[model samples]
Target: MLAMNYRGPYRVRAETMPDPVIEHPNDAIVKVLRSCICGSDLHLYHGLVPDTRVGTTFGHEFVGEVIEVGSTVQNLKLGDRVIVPFNVFCGTCYFCQRELYGNCHNTNPQATAVGGIYGYSHTAGGYAGGQAQFVRVPFADVGPTKIPDELLLEDAVMLTDAFPTGYQAAEMGDIREGDTVVVFGAGPVGIFAAKSAWLMGAGRVIVVDHVEYRLEFVRGFAQCETVDFKSVKDMALHIKKMTDWLGADVCIDCVGCEAAGSALQHLTGVKLKLQGGSATALHWAINSVRKGGNVSIVGVYGPTFNAVPIGNAVNKGLTLRMNQASVKRHLPRLIEHIQAGRIEPHRVISHVMPLEEVADAYHLFSSKLDGCIKTVLIPPGVTA
Candidate 1:
């Protein structure tokens, strides 16, 4: 099978890999039909995430047809079309029981902070991802959901990660009716976060980013106001001025780890590998929201300290919430929204390439070239 092979920082290519087989009783072997390049995948591509071993494939958002299943896999069978969530979790664990599948304790023995994630890295349980012709899925009954007849495969693929993560970011905000919300970053997750904020009854939604194309895309896609952080002197101050000096009721950070703002942050965190990742977005969110307001973060950051404004957060009585999105937990409501035409998840896709061209797909997304917002990969032999 051909898979996206990780060589090192800024290096990935399509290479021959052995086809995956069922390794556990609950495992399933999925022949991938559609997969996507997620924003978080860039972190691994750039070597921002720790323990990302060489030769590992990197992808977590994928949908496929189940070609084979182990003895214990009862919910799925051969010929079932399914969409697998990013998280590799056991459903009966304490965190899973609470619907926090992203933090499941039974997977990823290397760390206790996060559960196993497909194709992330060794720190994420070293599980190979679906950026291949085939992938091994653990806890098949709990994680892989059969795609509904009414859903498009492209849409189902996006729901695996970006959509759910974005929706979860909004849910973490606990937005009240008529509240003013500001989202940092205009990537897929940020766009979805902004869109979901409206669904949660936010009176106004604003997206902050320095990229001109992304800002324009989010304005049309999320139907929200846009701000180019590069044009402003102080982003936090600008947000305060926009809100009549009261600041926004809620602020979200969708640009994690690789946030490009502040010379010191970029030099130390992203360049020097000193901290987990740049905390520029987190800094902006902490200082930009109204005192006693809510702040939600769905950005991917490494397990380490960031130079954040803890003193200001404590002084201003802000409510800070963050976590990896529990994709399984949000699927039902999101599916309803998609089916109802309230949210078109596939609209975010800007490019689609054959799986054999996986390397070029990565370059396009990583370089943000060709007005790319999202890119989906089609496995060999899959017509769609």
Candidate 2:
């Protein structure tokens, strides 16, 4: 089967790979119907993630039909369409019991520094990702969410990571009704942060980024204000002016590594103590929030230490909340919203192509094409 495989830095190709089969009795083989590139994928695309294996399949966000279920997999059966959570997890682990599936101890080895991630480092268990014709789903009963027939896979696929990550960032920031929020980075995940913040009853949302296209796109969604970081001499003032001279009540960072700064030099005042592509939008969020406020981060950082001044955050009474998405806790509700048409996340999906065109899609996504807010890979013969 042809898949998007990592060749080297800034290089992903459509190449033939071994067909997937059940590796564990609890595993299931999913015939992928739709898959999408994540902002994290860019970490490798830009040569940020170290020790990245060559020719490894490179994606985790996907929806698929169950081609075969393992002997112990009774909850999902063949022909069932489902959304696979980006984090492969066993539902019964200690972390999972606490509603934190992203840190499932079973899938992530006992001593994993960072939890397992699909197509990421071996520290992440190097599990094959969903960006292929078929994916081997570990802990199928616990990880792969069975999508209702009324729901579209393209819309729900983002639930695996992007939407859930965005929601987690906002929820962690402790957004309150009538609160004003600012989200750094206007990529897919950041856009979801804007959407989720408003859905949770935020009075105003400000999205900061240089991408005019994304800022313009945010207008289609109600109650969002956009700030082109390139145009501002003082981003803090720009945010304050939009929010009645008070800084944002809550802030979220969704574009992690890709949003690493020093790109905006015109801006004055406090800059997040960031260097190179390390601190990312999370640092910006910390700088953008009001004193005594909160900054939530869902952006994935590479394996490195960033110097965050704990004293500065403490002096201002700022709270920091961040994590990979705990999808198990939020998936059901997000899916329910999708099923109810309460959120049309599909608006972010701007491209669709056959699996054979996987390489082309990767290049387009890697380059961040004009119409490519998100690109979903539809396997052959996938209908609706």
Candidate 3:
């Protein structure tokens, strides 16, 4: 088997690796049909995430078929088309009982510190992720979901991460019907955040990103307004003026640290603040919200501390909820939406390449070249 390995900063290669097997009773193995290149995966490539191996399998978003199952896996079966949740978690843990599946204590080795994530880092579960032909899945009954045959693989691919994550950010942020919502970062997650804001019944969904292509892509969705942050110094005022000075009711930050291209923009200086204030999407979202509005953040962060504006949050009586997706809780509902064709998350994908060309795809996605909004790496023989 060949896997994309994180060799060092800005270095990743498609390298041959041993095949994975079920190491636990709750484990299942899926033959990856379509995997993705995520913004967070760039963290591993850049060597920003600590404890990850130089050559750990490196992707988190995917859809695939269940080729094998474990003793405890009752609900899932062989030949089932499924979406692999980015996180590997035991269903019966203390945090799992509270629906915080990402923080599950049993599966992840670093469970004492935080939740475990696939293809994320050693700090997570260190589970080899789905950036290749086959991936080991833990807690299959609770982890993977079977999709309808009528639904496309690409549709299910999104459920694994971006789509649900974008929606989860808004859900945790307390987005409501007819409320004005502003989402920062028009990247994949940001676009999903904007779509979820509208689906959750936000009166107006406003998106912020400097990329012309991304903001333009958001236009296909109904009832959306967008802003290029590079054009505005005072983002809050810009949003307020667009909203007739009413401000938004909820704001979501989906960009995390890597906005536009790389989170280490200041360190890399390659793009020169590629997305500008998008680096502080949270700060802008908090400022753009109405006095009592809610702010939700869903971007993946490095294991470090950065100064957040507590003063404004305290003074305005803002409600804040920020974290990774509770995939167990969010996945089922998203699956239903997919079955009904209420939303087509696949619209965000701009390219689909064969699995063998994984290395080329990564370079394009990292460089943000060729108008690459999203790229899905299909298995070599995947038939259209």
Please list the residue runs of candidate 1 whose C-alpha ends up more than 4 Å from where it truly belongs after superposition.
Answer: none
List TM-score per model, in order: 0.99, 0.92, 0.92
lDDT of 3 at 317: 91
Order of candidates by lDDT, top first?
1, 3, 2
Best by TM-score: 1
lDDT of 2 at 125: 74
Off by over 4 Å in 2: 110-113, 263-276
lDDT of each: 0.93, 0.77, 0.79
RMSD of each: 0.7, 3.4, 3.1
Tens-digit lDDT track of model 3 for 140-170: 8888878877888888888888888888887
TM-score of 1: 0.99
TM-score (C-alpha, index-matched) for candidate 3? 0.92
What lDDT does candidate 1 reach at residue 244?
A: 94
1-384, model 2: which lDDT tens digit per residue? 777778887777777889988888989998888888887887766667666788788787888889898899888989888888788777887888887777778776733545667776555777888788888888888777788777767677888888888888788989889999998877888888888898888888888888777778876753488777778877666776776676789988776655535644212111332332456466567666788898887877655556455776787689998777887689888988887777888888888887778778777876768567788887666764
